[model samples]
Target: MTTHLITGAGSGIGAVLAQRLLERGDDLVLLARSASRAAELAASYDGARTVVADLADPASVEGLDLPASLDSVVHAAGVVELGAVADLGVASWLEQLTVNLVAPAALTRVALPALRAARGTVVLVNSGAGLTAHPQWSAYAASKHGLKALADSLRTEEAEHGVRVSTVYPGRTATAMQEKVHAQEGKDYDAADWIDPGTVAATILHLLDVPRDATVPDITVRPNA
Candidate 1:
């Protein structure tokens, strides 16, 4: 059975992905800022375990005690702070970059040896903002764009190590984060207009199911408008 470590496993896409992996008989190591939620989810599965780590904190991420080897690592934890460049505070910009970009890179760095040993895959959960910049999403867009770059670089760098890196750029999804974004825009949240988190999880699973010789480096999933 493949062993996978998933960040942001407490809810949304992360939680859905964890459940799907468990259902398929994969062992899971879940990480989240809230220990309670991660612990609760781990308890429901026989071989599942939980790790409490605040991805925004570099020290915390660096200190993670993960398994010696893992078949996959999913970096799904992210924070979105929306505002134009001029009005966005430096702190907010840094926070967005830290959680959305830096943390993933750091976690992947720590997991590199294990990934190499297992010929594993690294999945970065990015967003549509990574490809296009919108008026009020400067900070979020910048971080995601950076994340896209990170994934591309890793794919190239880790190729010889037999470790694959894939980035998923999903459009607005029916997640709590989407609700917060809608509230900030003074718009009502509509699940119909967004992609389902399960759909995205299924896409990741498909990527994993591909032959070891084949690699899908980037995937873009958007709602059908």
Candidate 2:
């Protein structure tokens, strides 16, 4: 069975992806900021293991104990801070970049040896913000854009190791994070206005299903009107 490790498995797209992978008979190692949530998920799944770690902390990521080999590592943990560049505090900006960009890079680096051993795949869950910047979203946009650059660089560098890196850019997925974003925007939260997290999870699964000789490096999933 393929073994996969997923960060942010406590909620949202990460949790949904874990469920999908479990249903498909893959072994999972779930990492989340909430130990209780990760434990609950592991208990529900027959062979899933839980690791509680704050991905924003470099020390926490560097010390992660993982299997010697892994079929995939999905960096689904992220944070967003919305404000015009002039109004956003340096702390908020750094926090957003740390969680949304730096943490993924650090975790991927830690997992590189295991991933290389298995000739595995690395999936970065990015956002449409990575593709375009809008008003009051400067910090978040910059972090995601950095994430896109990270994925692109990793794809090229790891190709020689027979490892594939793919990135999914989803447009406003309906999750707790979307609710937070809507609240910050002073708009009523409407799930209908966003893409479904399951749809994004399905797309990642498709990327993994492709033959080893081929790769779908980048995918964009936008909400339909």
Candidate 3:
């Protein structure tokens, strides 16, 4: 059975993805900021193990102890700070980047040994914002753009080492993050326009379901109007 490590497994798409993976009979490792939430999720997923760590904190990431070998890593942890470029605070900007970009890359680097050993896939949950800029979304766009670059670089660097990287550009997923963005907008964004989190998880599973001789570098899953 494949062992999958998923970050941000406490809520939103991350939680949904974890559920699908668990049902598929994969051993799971859930990493999240809140231990209680992670524990609850773990309990729901056949008592899977939980690791508590803040991805934004470098020391916390560096201190993680995972299995000696991992079949895959679904990097579902991310953050969003909405504001015009001028109004976005430097500190908040860094925090967003830390969680959305730096932490993923750093975590991937740390998990390299185990991933390479298992020829594992790294699933990066990027966003449409990374591909197209929008007003009041400067920080999110920048972080996702950086994350896309990281995925590309890792794919090239790790292929020879037998590890594959997959970057997912999903548009307006019906997640808590999306709700937060909509709530702050003073209007209800069309939930009908949102992509199903389960569908996204299935797409990710497709990326890993490929033959060992094949590789899928990138994919865009958007809700069609």
Candidate 4:
């Protein structure tokens, strides 16, 4: 059975992706921030395994217990706080950077062996902010940009091992994150105006379904409307 370890499976795109994978009868392992979250995920996705690690503290990701082998590791969990460069506090920057960048790196480093054993794929669910930075998004964008760099470098380093790396940049998805972003922007949010979480999740599923003979390096998804 193909096995996948997913972060951010509690909500939004990650949650939708987890459900899709489960519906297909795939072996699923979810990364939870706490024991309570793990229990919730277990109840939500029966037959799925869970590992606890707090992304807010990157150090927590080190030496985490994981499956012996995995077909994919999807880094979908992230945090975002919006404020001007001059207004954003150091703690805010560190929080976003730790949860969005450092923790994923730490977890992926630990999962490399399992990924290599399965010739697995590493999918980083980035943001459009990763590509182009807007005002009040300095910290979050910086972290995402770093995430892109991480994927690019890891792609080259892991290629020889047949491990693939991909980064998906989804724009304004109708997830809780989007709601938060809207609130930060002080704008009204309508789900119909944004991309559906399932759409982004489907694109991720496509990356996983791609033949071994070919690989997708980066994908950027935006709402048509």
Candidate 5:
């Protein structure tokens, strides 16, 4: 069984992804900021382990230690604070960057030892905003742009070691993060029109199923209605 490490396993796509992996007989290490939710999910999987780490605080991720032979990693923990650029608070902006960009990069760096050993893959869950911008989404777009760049660069840097990097850019998934921002903005967006979390989770699993010789550099999924 392959050992997979996932960040943001508390809810949304992360929670669904954890369940999918567990059902497929993958050993897992779930990293999240909430202990209660982590424990709940851990109990459902036979070999699932949980680590409480706040991505906003980089130091929190530093103390974590995973097996030196992890087969895969999914960086799904992210934040989206929507508002006019001028109204964006410094603290809110920093928190977005810390969780979406800095923490993922830091965790990947720390896990390089194990990834290289297993010739594992790194999966980054980015946003369509990272590719194209829109109003009231500056912070989210900027952080996702950074994540995209990091994923691209890491792909080249780690390729020689037989490690692969894959990135997924999904448009408006039905996640709590999306719902929270939608509620705050009062935009009344339709969740049914967005990509499905289960479908996205299946995509991640597909990437994992690909033969080692195959590489899916980047993929974007959007609902068509």
Candidate 6:
């Protein structure tokens, strides 16, 4: 059976991806910010399993109980609080940096041995903001940019071990996070205006389902409007 460990399985693309995998009878280990949150996800995903950790606190990653060998690690948990460089407080900057970038790197480090043993994949769910920065997206973009760098370096370092690293950059997706972004921008959100999270989830699954002989280093998904 295929096994995938995923963060942010509670919602958005991760949630859709988890549901698809579960329906196909794949094994899953999901991350939850707290024990209560873990319970919620357990019930939501039909009691698959979960590990408790706050992505905003990178130190919490050191305690994650990951499987000995697994097929994949999907870093989909992220937070964004849009503010210009001039006004974004240090707390906001730190939280985004820790959750969106630092925590993934730390978690991947601990999962390396298991990944190598299985010659698995590590997929990082990034954003279009990772590629282009607008006026109020400084902190979030910087963290995602750093995440891209992390993946590039890891891809090379782990190549000999046969573990593939891929980063998927999705354009504005209709998720609670996008709604928050619209609220910050003082604009109304219309889910129909954005790409469906399930579409992006399908893209991630394609990368995972491909034949073992080849690997995709990066992919970008954008709305067709």
| TM values, all candidates | 0.96, 0.96, 0.95, 0.99, 0.95, 0.98
Ten contiguous residues with the weakest lDDT in model 2 = 32-41
True-structure lDDT of candidate 2:
0.89
Every candidate's lDDT: 0.89, 0.89, 0.86, 0.95, 0.88, 0.93
Q: For residues 1-225, write the lDDT of model 2, one tens digit per residue.
A: 899999877778988898999998998998867667767877876789877778668568777888999999998888887998889999999899999988888889999999999999999999999999999999999999999999999999999998999999999999999999999999999897888899999998888788998988899999996
Compose the digit string of candidate 1's lDDT tens values, residues 1-225: 799999877678987998899988998988867677766766766579887778778568776788888899998889998887889999999999999999889889988988999999999999999999999999999999999999999999999999999989999999999999999898988988999999999998987777898999999999998
Model 5 residue runs over 4 Å out of place are: 34-37, 44-46
- Candidate 4 clashing pairs? none
Q: Which 10 successive residues of model 1 have the least lDDT summed? A: 37-46
* Top candidate, metric lDDT: 4
Query: How displaced is residue 51 in candidate 3, in Å?
Result: 1.4
Off by over 4 Å in 1: 44-46
Tens digit per residue, CA lDDT, model 5, 174-207: 8888888788788786778777898888888889
Q: Tell me the spans in candidate 4 whose CA falls farther than 4 Å from its real position.
A: none
lDDT of 4: 0.95
Look at candidate 1 and tell me the lDDT of residue 133: 95
After superposing candidate 3 on the true structure, give the runs of residues whose Cα lies further than 4 Å from its correct spot. none
RMSD of each: 1.3, 1.3, 1.3, 0.6, 1.4, 0.8
Residue range 67-129, candidate 3, lDDT tens digits: 889999999878887888888899979998899998898888888899998999999999999
Cα lDDT tens digits, model 6, 17-98, are 9999999999999989999999999999985888988888778878678888889999998999998889999999999999
Tell me the RMSD of model 5 versus the true structure. Answer: 1.4
Best by TM-score: 4
Error of 4 at 42 (Å): 0.6
